[model samples]
Target: MTEPILPRIRPEIAALAPYKQGRQAGPDAFKLSSNENPFDPLPSVVSALQSATPINRYPDAAATRLRERLASRYGVGSDQVHVASGSVAILYQLVQAVASVGDEVIYAWRSFEAYPGLPLVAGATGIPVPLTEDSRHDLDAMADAVTERTRAILVCTPNNPTGPIVTSAEFEAFVARVPADVLIILDEAYAEFVTAEDAVDGLAERVYEQHPNVVVLRTFSKAYGLAGLRVGYAIGHTAVLNAARATGIPLSVTAAAETAALASLDAEAELLQRVAVLVERRTTVIAALRAQGWDVPDSQANFVWLPTGERTDEVAAVFLDADIVVRPFSGDGIRISVGEHESVEKVLQAAQSVVERRQ
Candidate 1:
């Protein structure tokens, strides 16, 4: 076959693979693949979505109401709050805003899979600092990796896939080491699920006030069960947010998304009650896994990491056979989202099967 002529594309972007999401499960299977809230949307959120109509008109390109609401809750100006389709969208915007060709963006390895791609999209080099043996960010090592070419650093709390958080003191110390000019993004997608008192609270700690370069990215996806709607926001310096806004695709936040997010906030008390339940489930799942002799990380997020090592795929097969779909990283491990209560026993059963095989 003759080679087809192709449009000129950046070699780096051409080499990149599109983002892969967790596998969808069969109807009878429990999907613990994505770290998603197993619970259904709250009634208030549902009502808001139902009432949202006239899709004929374009959405508020600014996401004005949602930004104002988030601003009030965080005690920041609306100008400082940037709402996007999802926190990950803001991640892309922030990276594009600061880093580009020849610049470097630093983040922990085995973290949110999106981290590596964000830098690549902006024509920047990604400097991934490996996690500690315990699956936590080595803040000191990350700080040491910084160079004059470094433009941004991403910190994912309750670090994804591995499941541990950087403590407040550790973050403060890390921040002191990084130059004030470097942008630091705090990706707190799972913040609402964190139970650790010492875990860095971006909003509560007011880190942005002390460090203008800091931007906190949050989403209504996990805790609020608005994953499908894709509403996330960022709290940071107005100028920084403005830059992100300039780079973003306009009117991406649909009216339904903003309305549902607003409703989620109004029913925050009740929605948080659901989060509390998930937290309890997370606690139980972690304890059970630990008791089973698995070297599971101490996860404060809504998922637990199973370091299955070389047996990763084989172990994942075991779960699949048991009708429990899990997110498995080829040679590393599996990340099991804390899902429906009924699925717990099935998860443990499949896990026990893997343990028995090893014996």
Candidate 2:
């Protein structure tokens, strides 16, 4: 009998647990786990999709037209924009382009879970700097963590998990200290949700004009109500954009996705109005949670974070029992995405019930 043969895999890959997404528990479950737009797609965008045909043909490999549109909007040439399947894909490509085996990539701890994994997958080391006490990115600490072997640093504005933003001044100072060769990726997936005056613009207009090393990542997923469509892009130096494109898989972005993204850009005003509504709801939810004595951080993103620590699981369970799906970060915190009015009310009620029972 031949000995049982098992396929060998990378130790990190074998040890990693699959990423879990928020599940729709039932038909009536109020899902506030994944930070998605609660609004429907704009009529113009919908019509554009309906009009699109020939799904048989492959998508434009370069995403040329879409890149042109983005470039014009951002006041850059076509060479500066690199569209991808989504911002996450662009992020992965960035890691691969800049990081080599044993190089270090630094980012804030608990900002984006994918941050740590992206560098690891590129055969690079990740150095996660701890967040500040107020749950914002500690840019000072992150800048300090950069060393001779550091190749890249990722900063998530209106950061995931905590949702606070890094100020423009803070970001500027941090970038000044980082080595010119080290690429700085400013992941602005939640940029549209921010309303603060000091929030980093993330278009890379100011930063890129002065510092060629900074790259800004944005997506049509959240504000554009195109999460399912999977379209995002990177704005940076033409050189960095070219490097990212070099590592990109051929035909990674589908035709439908490109159509949706272009249409969404045309409907930007309407989508921003919906984002305003979400911001209002986020404010309401955060205030309510704080009133209930929860340690809620000041979030500029579409979601709110409650640092319940070990109680996170229990809180999530309570919401689940109430048919409201929330995301709990094991022993770290619980994140609830702000949704439509009724869904927001349901979350509040479920939270109240849980807190009352605990009291």
Candidate 3:
């Protein structure tokens, strides 16, 4: 039976499909559906969370200390750093602050799946530029797509699902073409997993310093294994960030999250060693997939892209039956994350079996 429809709901929001999270696997399966850090929580981080205070009170509204730490690390003032529950939340705030009815937000399609839905809720149109044949962003095409109606542009490095990164040269050139008034967001959620030397590091490169309109979004969720805590930060001009801050859900950040982030910072070295392992696993996955005759993209991030195209669903199911869960963009491809060390052989075995069937 058809569900009853609500009256007077915003048509755009009603039409928008909900953002999908990756599937979870059974206890016997390795869950590689989400690009999550496979390591268990560090002992120090756990201890810090256990030491939280003032459960009766709210968290720091501004996330003052976290912002200050980030600012110092990035060589920016505290005012220039903005922290939110997650980078995705910061994306929503930035979108609502800049785009509205009749405004347009441009980004590469098959990028972050969340990019399209963000503008819809903001009452803005989302323009999705097609990715190139190699599944990398067509920066030139994106620059050409910009118009007076364009309010913001999001560039994802080592882009989600598809693992290619935007080169520093292309990014610099694209920034040159974008109008100064249009807000540009570099969503580097997977920067820590990036091993390619040529890939643009949005925060480390400090693109925001030269372009006042640019903002960089990053999250500890991926590298630090803090997805459950949900903390992320942004670096940009204070004026632009203030606009996002105004749209922010007040006191949404928690003391536990702030403390956890601080503890993660303290444990950065150990966490990065884990990232290095994932990177090696990613390399092995790519090599194995290629040997199986699958044309995997050059993934600098922690995931590999299998452009299964029309076979996406079938291929995903094969992996599922083999006790491995993965994210499949139906009719397009599959995104298999580099997960636990034990999962490596399982993933390759599943992929090889699927490849044999195809052949």
Which candidate should be chosen as best, given TM-score against the real structure?
1
Clashing pairs in 3: none
Candidate 1, run of 10 with poorest lDDT: 45-54
- Report each candidate's C-alpha RMSD, comma-separated, in the order given: 0.8, 1.5, 1.6
Clashes of 3: 0
lDDT of each: 0.93, 0.88, 0.92
lDDT (tens digit, per residue) of candidate 2 on 204-273: 4458768899999999999898999889998889999899999999898888788888888887888888
Better of 1 and 2 by TM-score: 1
Model 3 agreement with the true structure over 7-48: per-residue lDDT tens digits: 898988888889899997898999998899989999999999
Q: Could you estimate the TM-score for every candidate?
A: 0.99, 0.97, 0.97
Which runs of model 3 end up more than 4 angstroms from their true locations? Answer: 1-7
Task: Please tell me which predicted candidate would have the highest lDDT against the true structure.
Answer: 1
lDDT of 1 by residue, 118-180 (tens): 999999999999999999999999999999999999999989988898899999999999999
Once fitted onto the true fold, the runs of candidate 1 whose alpha carbons sit more than 4 angstroms away are: none
